[model samples]
Target: MDLAWVRQHVRQAAAELGFGLVDQTKLVTAASELARNTLVHGGGGQVESTVLQNGLARGLRLTFTDEGPGIPDIERALSDGYTSGGGLGLGLGGARRLVHEFSLDSRPGAGTAVTVICWVAGPPRQRKEMR
Candidate 1:
């Protein structure tokens, strides 16, 4: 998959979905890290985005899934700067910091799935009537 295009698409989608500048930046950064992990470690994966609705509230959810060699130690993988390869190891941990909610599920030889959910910060409200 085209990582740059994926990141750009995420940025555009976030903007169109009414996420603020800071939120959009965070989403883009998270997408980058997740996409790289999917490519380098997971061998291949998919990223999906959906609009989230909680009653009168609205938000966005992003899921990244992979079917490659699973992580052997999730805790170590999540530790900052803990990479097996000689590469910077900020992908998963940094991603966790960038979202309101983050979850990961994986086991050795069982693949991995990462889900992140972030809301726009408030419920939608209609304008008050003018006197």
Candidate 2:
């Protein structure tokens, strides 16, 4: 999948969900980094984004999946300043910090799948009655 296109799609989705500018930027940045990792490290993969609602709260969830050489040490991978691709090593960790929920699944030869969710705090907004 194209990195830029993925980022654009994620940003647009966040905006459509009424995410504030800062929240939108955070989600976009995280999506961009993860998407690039999926392409460069995982030899290309798939990204899925969806809207989530829990009680009064709403959120956006993104999932990245790839069938490449999977991570052998998930903990080490999540550590700051640790990278296999000579990057700043902030993609996974940073992305985790930017969202409310984060999950990663991988094995040495199986593959990798990362899911993230960003939810708006407080109760859900009240809808107005139609005239």
lDDT winner: 2
lDDT of 2 by residue, 1-131 (tens): 38879988988878767677899999988888888888888898999888898876779999999999998899988888777775535668888898889999999888899999998755544546899
lDDT of 1: 0.81
Q: Candidate 2, which ten residues in sequence have the lowest lDDT sum?
A: 119-128
TM-score of each: 0.84, 0.87
Candidate 1 local lDDT, 1-131, one digit each (tens): 47897789888877766787898899888888888888788898898889887765567788989998898888988888776673335668878999899999998888899998877746443445799
Error of 2 at 13 (Å): 0.6
Identify the leading candidate in terms of TM-score.
2
Flag regions of model 2 displaced more than 4 Å: 86-89, 121-131
TM-score of predicted structure 1: 0.84
lDDT of 1 at 44: 82
